[model samples]
Target: MPWFQLVANGDATDPNDYNAVGGPSCSGPNHICAIQASPNTNNKPIITTPLRNEMITALNTNSSSTNVQLRTNP
Candidate 1:
């Protein structure tokens, strides 16, 4: 197992120095797995208005209007 040594910023080379570190802190449910609904806040104004989908594709990934499929075939 690997050991972690927490030393002061300026006293990193000092062998006699020891620093306290923080542990994991959580105040919610111990373990919970659920689908998270994330919203897309970044989108082009012109492409977002016409599309009915809430989560729009990112505009900075060299993507164009033709890259998106607006409909599904029956």
Candidate 2:
């Protein structure tokens, strides 16, 4: 298995270098997951949002739009 890191930026609110409070550090969880409740976070408007998804998809050779698919499926 591969490893990942969440370097802190001296901010305590953001995800610690180990996913303590928030995640990967950022302005905030001001996206859908924390607001709209759309369940469409796979493409969250944040960087780390799509980063992990894409990485996993690349390693598994799967489409990264799984959320999009779920939205269109019956």
Candidate 3:
């Protein structure tokens, strides 16, 4: 998720009225509120290398085994 705040020249009615790509824009009669974003929750993994083929094979296998398996790089 993210967080935002209303800035000067920003209208409280329409927050998305102004384009907020290259920072805040407060140069009009219709006050534009500045929008800011907060850091996102870190759950995604940063993989620099390709995943092992064996792991992919096991995951693709449809077996009746009850034991769960975990794969990790050594």
Cα lDDT for residue 44, model 2? 22
Per-prediction TM-score to the true structure, in the order listed: 0.16, 0.21, 0.21
Let me know the TM-score candidate 1 reaches against the reference structure.
0.16
Candidate 2, residues 29-52, lDDT tens digits: the string is 222111111222332223355544
- Give the lDDT of residue 59 in candidate 2: 33
What would the TM-score be for candidate 2 when compared with the true structure? 0.21
Q: lDDT value for candidate 1?
A: 0.23
lDDT of 1 by residue, 12-70 (tens): 22223322222212122211111112122321122233331321442223232332222
- Per residue, candidate 3 scores C-alpha lDDT tens digits across 17-70 of 323244332333322223333322342212112322322333456221121122
Scored by CA lDDT, what does every candidate get? 0.23, 0.27, 0.29
1 or 2, greater by lDDT: 2
Worst 10 residues of 3 by lDDT: 63-72
Using lDDT as the measure, which candidate wins? Answer: 3
Model 2 CA deviation exceeding 4 Å by range: 1-47, 62-74
